[model samples]
Target: MLSTNSTAVAEFQRKSAQAQAALEKVRGRGTAGNGATSAMVDAGGRLRDLTFAPTAAKWGDRIPALVLKASRAAEQDAIAQVQKITKPLTDDPRLRQTLAETKSLLSAEEPGKRRPRPKAEESEDAYFRNFSPHDPR
Candidate 1:
């Protein structure tokens, strides 16, 4: 019985190391602004590159927004790959605590994966309604 448990633990460790190595190789590519803006990020959500195509000239005033959009897209891509790497490990009942620890190491949330926010568009009583349409409060 002891040997069986020990072997299982060793196998789990091997798979964990393999997954970590695979995660290190992940490079997420994303583009936005009609493909004029591009970004790449590593599995840890660090920006690796940013570039703008010649077509970006038409977006002179909006270039900053394009950059932000592209970066977020790249980060989301990295996060997705990280999730894929960790999925099998997380499914193991004995590894639940490790999953929580892994969540802390991630720099960005997976876009569109967060819980729905309370609707700020749903106004309060007319007398109490504020002017901000986007405010979560």
Candidate 2:
């Protein structure tokens, strides 16, 4: 029993370290304003660097808007990077099963008692692949 508990703890620690490392390794970049502006961001969309092309001088009053666009792009790029890096963490079937078990143990309600979440509408390709005249939904 003690060995089992210690192993679980070690596994949790290892996963946590992996997540931290993935975040630390993330680097996202974005460009906007017709290549006149560019920015680099880290995990939290924190600005790491910024650059402006010679054409930026011609943009004049448009520089501020270009900067905003570049920053927003960089932030989105960072978010995408983080998602790609950490996807495996949540994709593990064992992790999902463990979470369900933990929830069942901790909650007052009966196991598997939660309401079903609403799913997004399927894409046309998916719908066509499983099409049935009687099944409109």
Candidate 3:
């Protein structure tokens, strides 16, 4: 029994090490305002670098917003990188089952605390029609 437990623990450690290595390889980059601003984030979603074009400061009051947008893009890029690397592991049946179980447990609520589900739009066309003029679609 002790041997079995020890083996399981060792396997877990090995998997954990592999995951850490993959995460370390993750590098996310984000750009805003047609390359006017940019940011890079690591696997842990920590900012690694930021750059701005010479004209970036001319935007004045919009500088903060531009920086925020670029930062968000970088964070998303990092998350995508991590997801791409871990896809195989995440696709495991055991992991899926565990995630589903955990989600259900977390979503459970008392009788009076249940939230109403939002109704789906009756027409998909109506949803698309609401798109802004600037939308590519």
**Number of colliding residue pairs in each model:** 0, 0, 0
Worst 10 contiguous positions by lDDT, candidate 3? 1-10
Error of 3 at 60 (Å): 1.8
Q: In candidate 2, how many Å is residue 29 off?
A: 0.9
lDDT tens readout by residue for model 2, 1-137? 44654565567668878889889977778888789999888998889999999888998998989888998998998999888877777776656666676676688666679755445434655778899999968
Model 1, 1-137: lDDT tens per residue? Answer: 44654665676798899998999899988898999999999998888999999999999999999989999999998989888898887777545544445565573677668655556634444426555767766
Ranking by TM-score: 2, 1, 3
lDDT of 3 by residue, 1-137 (tens): 44654555565557668888989988889988877899999998898999999878777888878888999999999988888877756665554555566677787876568565555543655777787888886
Give candidate 2's error at residue 104 in angstroms.
1.1
| lDDT agreement with native, every candidate | 0.81, 0.80, 0.78
* Worst-scoring 10-residue span by lDDT in model 2: 115-124
Clash number for candidate 1? 0
Top-scoring candidate (lDDT): 1
The RMSD of every model to the true structure, in order and in angstroms, is 17.9, 15.9, 19.4
Candidate 1 stretches with Cα past 4 Å from truth are 94-137
